[model samples]
Target: MDELTLRIYPSVRAAAPDLETPGLAGYAFARHAWLQAWADTFGAQAHIEPAIVVMAGVRIQMVLPLGITRRNGLRTLEFLGGIVTDYNAPAIDPDFARSLDATAVQALWRRITAALPSHDVVCLTRMPVTLDPPEGAVGERVPNPLALLPGVNAAGQARSVTFPDRYEALTGTLRPRFWADTQRCRRRLAEVGPIAFVVADDDAGMRALIVSLKRMKSRRWRETHSKDWFAVPAFSDFYDAMARIDLPEGRIHGSSLNVSGTAVAAHLGLVYRSRFYLLLIGWEADGWRRFSTGRLMTETLLRQAFDEGLRVFDFTVGEEAYKDDWANALMPLVRYDEAITARGRFATVLMTARDRLRARATQVAWLRRIVRWLAGRPLA
Candidate 1:
């Protein structure tokens, strides 16, 4: 194996030249504006630092924007975006990525692992296995090359919709049941009022939709007994800042599904290259459940995106049933956990055991109920 030069930057601003990496810019999550927003917004509290790695002076082999925090008295390292960031792999150039064999990849990991600043354990979640573009598309297809890194398949996988040139062809390719269901959903929604789909025309419009999405998500979380992530001021602020970013290649995009004159559903996502990353989506809670407003909004957004010539609608991460019904492809994402110290090793064992238990809990309803119950207070 040839020796490779590794350079580490303390922050994204310090990693300017490497962030301009050619060939990989379009799909590189580290280069996305949202990342920088996340770093600055959550920087102080999270101790987030950009650990972007550049190889041989000019080539960006991998970029890991990381954050260091103390967990149970042991310093732990994790991806900056936490659970919200769907894909978390080092952005290696596609050509360089495809050429890597086991020995080369192992060597690469050695260099990356050695550079971390005194952390007990490192956890990078939602790392995609492949970087391949849609089939017949102009971009490259990476077949989960990063899975070669030491990691395990995560409990939940990512999902995406590969659109055809036309909307009719796209729906025609769906399962008959899904296609029929989609048609019925839209028809029923249309009967309630004049259906209108609108994309945010300005910053104010985008901010308004995002605020509405947060409210909708909070209500949903309460029903499921799940923590509302957007409740964090910094997280919501990071998203609001991302929505206002203006760039020629891409910027955060917001859209709404309106019934007559009211917004029944709102979505805020990123538009990069020719792909649409579906990030946050929510619908009005008042009597809108019967309309299946969220599903209808997704269908409307798909048609709009297809007509606009976007190739992929990435539902980001999660194994949601709705995503399975809508997406034509499944993008597998894995998690990497490594221990560098004795404390780290002990934590790793605990984490692994917890993961195994969680996986099993998903299979048994009584177990899931018990887990949720334990997560709450018994009585006042």
Candidate 2:
């Protein structure tokens, strides 16, 4: 027990200065490198604040990258990735993992929460259930996590619609009915004009596509009085940084699906871990909506991924109808907390109720139709 020393730092830049870190390419859209790059690009618009959960012995060792804040003087900790990051967890020291068990790791969270009181929300999201606790710890600090949605879209595993061994199993496995429709749509679109896979190999190219995506995504948000965080300076800087970093790291993989040399849809993703993480997306204004370029471009991208031998292709989070139809299957998600207090409990209750309602409604089509009707606005 005495062999380990604990430290929590205020900023990621200062957290693990000398530790052997994986250097930001791993998380692509949400890594610390991305955060810093964004800060540089937006010059203060980005929220670069990060905290680390570290345990050191003779020298600094394992670290858990995180974010924390004090709301109205109440201290709380949050996972840094938020909306932009997926597959997030603390990056532990390999040796640290060997030294600690599930109980001990749980104790670490216990210890960490005991230290912070200024923040009230001990919020955690997307924590895979298989996570282990550390040695000598009960994980008692963790608030019980609930399934993202109960049983509405159940009875299946999140298997690749195709098999891992061969690319054909997956791509060839797409809903045959949909594939037929897509073929017909593309044929009609081709008749209207030239359709293509436009590649933007430079910043200027990426910027143009992004401008289109933001313009399209924002139009819908504006009417609703809401905006994606990227619209803010901080988030935008981070995105621009994505373009600045070298390949397999900060590079932007943006392209357009076009007709008649006009961009009809855009696929905006980032390259990391030899796979592509789907990010912002958009379709051209009023140009052949019947074609479903969004879905077609997705099929094209997935085909490219398989052909390129990339193992995983994440659609990211959200329970959109299209995502459900195309992705292999839905995976359960968990929202966690280590030190939830009174107000936190109330907030959790509200959120739980909201999730349950949404889940129950997903089982029915009418609720969604009503929403679409109210939204009556066309897709932005």
Candidate 3:
């Protein structure tokens, strides 16, 4: 933990470390092995921004393949937060994880000073506290996190709700009327047309449904004049592959809400460790006005899950109103960032300046409208 006397060096490669290492899951996503996959597949042009946090004659942690971009002459390094990956903390031993924060902070600062010695800005986005703060003013940049993280420590969370057992336990949290309404929706759906279910397995039928869902989502986004998550080819592939990722390790349950043998809505979720995490969803535009395709799809999945004996049903991060009816528990997602060096400090300052201006603009009702409109677009 002292002045990293060990000759630790930094590399931008994303290779996997020893399996016997302490925190493999934490660093795997950020390592070269994972980042290269993202680079090749996601076209995530990045620098080989590498750093080795070594100790005890072994390589403990490695940080690599981060995007280093200069904006307005500010040399800023983003934490990457594995934009295309997840689990962005250091992988070290239990004992080592305890001392990792301090060692990592010093090592990171040294690397930033050495790599772009003149650059005085490091901007870490959506980083876990386990990564350790660089000891300065910390603030939320975009406020709403770019990605969702399932916080295990929901007890301390303000919006935390109790986790319900799968099946009735979840829907039981809602009003009795809500359950009756669900029954009514089912009856109405039956009255209007036949309802069917298509699950994404390895079969051609499943693959076809996934493809149709993608096309449906793309068209929906275009008609609404909004950007879609799968607009990029890599993301589209990710969406498709997602339907397959859990099948081998655990189980993947991607369902299509169909009517009269025709697909009306689709629910794409990842089922792991007896928990169903709602990922992305799509619906047929025509049926939306008649019957809430999205919510109905949830009911479909919920009943299916209960029948299958699944325990937890996570709606993921958003505090969206619709999730309330089915979510027996509410988990509030939080955002926090830390600057680790002279580089981090300056970047934080620049963000502060920009956000202040935005905040003032939002103070005026009329101006707020424009601010929201512009923000929906892209900001450098």
Scored by CA lDDT, what does every candidate get?
0.72, 0.58, 0.52
Q: Give the distance in Å from residue 105's predicted Cα in candidate 1 to where it truly belongs.
A: 1.0
TM-score (all chains, Cα) for each model: 0.86, 0.72, 0.66
Cα lDDT of model 3 by residue, 1-380, tens digit: 44333332343332334322333223234444334344454534334243333333344433323345554445555544245543334443334444334346456445534654344455444343332111121422111111222222221211212344545555667789977877777778888787887786666766777787787778878987978767777777655554544232235567798787888888766554345657567787765546767678877776776676655565654455777666555333334344546655666776787677688885678867776776645334
Sort by TM-score, top down from the best: 1, 2, 3
lDDT of 1 by residue, 226-265 (tens): 8887888877777777777654466677999998978999
Least accurate 10 contiguous residues by lDDT in model 1: 132-141
| Residue 252, model 1: Cα distance from true site in angstroms | 1.2
- Scored against the true structure, residue 307 in model 3 reaches a CA lDDT of 73
At residue 7, what lDDT does model 1 achieve? Answer: 76
What is the overall TM-score of model 1 with all chains considered together? 0.86
Estimate, for each residue in 76-166, the C-alpha lDDT of model 2 and write its tens digit: 6766555455544554443454455556656666676665434556766665432223223333222211222121122222212322668
The predicted structure with the larger TM-score, 1 or 3, is 1
Give the number of colliding residue pairs in candidate 2. Answer: 25
Question: By TM-score, who's the top model here?
Answer: 1
